[model samples]
Structure formats: C-alpha cells, structure tokens
Target: MRVLLVEDNGDFALPCRQLLAALRGVQVVQTAASAQEACDWLRANPGGWDLVVVDLFLGQGHGFTVLRECAGRPPLQRAVVLSAYADETARQYARKAGADAFFSKTNEMDALLAYCLQLAGEVDGANR
Candidate 1:
C-alpha cells in the first residue's frame, strides 16, 4: 500500500514512517508537513496514493482541512485521521470531513497499526 503521511513532527513522523516501512507491501511514498502541501501533492498526483494518514494538528494547517481536500477521492483511496486531539467531537468532525477512520495517537496506536496491516493485506480485518 502506498501511503501519504501528513505529519509535521519529526519525532512522531520518523517512528511512524519506520513502523509503516516495516510492514510488508506498505511504503510511505511521501510526507507533507501541512494541509496545503498535502493538498497540492494530491492534486498533482491524482490516484497516486492508496492511503493518507493525517494528523489533526499540523505545523501550518489543521487536518480537517486536509480531510476536506480529500473528500472527493475515489473509494479505493482512504483518508484516515491520526491525532492526539481525538476526542468525540473531533471524531465526529473527522467523519463528516471525509475520514475513513479516526485513531488517537495516545490511545489507539495499536488499532492504527492493525488497520494498516489489514489494508496491506497482511492481516484480516477480523484480527484487527
């Protein structure tokens, strides 16, 4: 699975990149630090990404804007929110903004990994 990871923090992005790279058949094709950059990249490369993992808070923009940018993507292309501010309100907004799933960085990291593994066909959804 080709992934576009939208995260500004090097601390989180580096570890997330390493983990995703360790997964079979999964590769993080690119990284964007802000919503505008991510949107521009997506526009420049239509159908170029299979998954976009976005953090709700970016250095230059909010992830909701990124989600909005990806709202019209094809069904095969998924946009998931990975954030520290993953409260109920945030989740509801994320869903409305076109996120396929929302996972909290502090509480649902395992679920995020499982979701990635399942998407990569490395594991079954039932297992996740």
Candidate 2:
C-alpha cells in the first residue's frame, strides 16, 4: 500500500511515518506539508497512490483543498482525514469534500491504524 501523508507538524508526521512503515504491505510513504504541495504531488502522481492521509490544519492552506484535489481519483484509491481538530463539523466537511474516513489524533489512532490495516489487506489480496 502506497500512502501520501499530508501533515505540517514534524512531531506528528514522524510517528505517523514510522507507524505506516512498520505496517505490512505499506511499501511507500510520502509526505506533503502544505495544501499546495499536496495538490501538486497528487497532480503529478495522478493514480499512483493507494491511499492519502491528510491533516486538516496545515502550515499553509487546509486539508479540504487536498481532499478536493483528490476528488477525481479512482474509486480504488482512498483518502482519509486525520486531524487534531476532528470535531463533528470537520468530519462532516471532510466527508462532503471526499474523505473516505475521519480519525481524531487525540483518541482514534487505533481506529486509524485498523482502517489502514484493512486497506492494506485488501491491497494484498488484490495483488495475490
């Protein structure tokens, strides 16, 4: 599973990268710190990524923009929002934008990992 992670904070990004790297079937993990960078990367890679994990509050711009950028992705490709500010409004907005799932950084880390694992298993099954 190839993942593009959009996050501004090094503190959060590092752990996320490490965790994803340790997961089975996660072959590549890329990082984009801002909305422009994320959008640019998404455009450049078209249907290259299997999954995108985005943070709502970025250093510049927002994850909603990134989600919008991913709106045209193939159905097999997935985007998820992982935010510190994962309130009801944010979750609804993310869903409306294009996010397949939303996870709170404070309390839903396990759920996020579980979702990723499920996606990875699917990818593995497809490859088999």
- Top candidate, metric lDDT: 2
TM-scores of the models, in the order given: 0.92, 0.96
lDDT per residue (tens digit) for residues 1-128 in model 2: 99999999999899998888788878555799999999999999986789999999998999999999999788779999999998899999999999999999999999988999999998778779
Tell me how many residue pairs clash in candidate 2.
0
Candidate 1 per-residue C-alpha lDDT over 37-114 given as tens digits, one digit per residue, 9 for 90 to 100: 999999898878888999998989989898888877876688999999989999999999999999999989889888
Residue 128 displacement in candidate 1 (angstroms): 23
Clashing pairs in 1: none
Worst 10-residue lDDT window for candidate 2 reads 21-30
Error of 1 at 63 (Å): 0.7
Q: CA RMSD for every model?
A: 3.7, 1.0
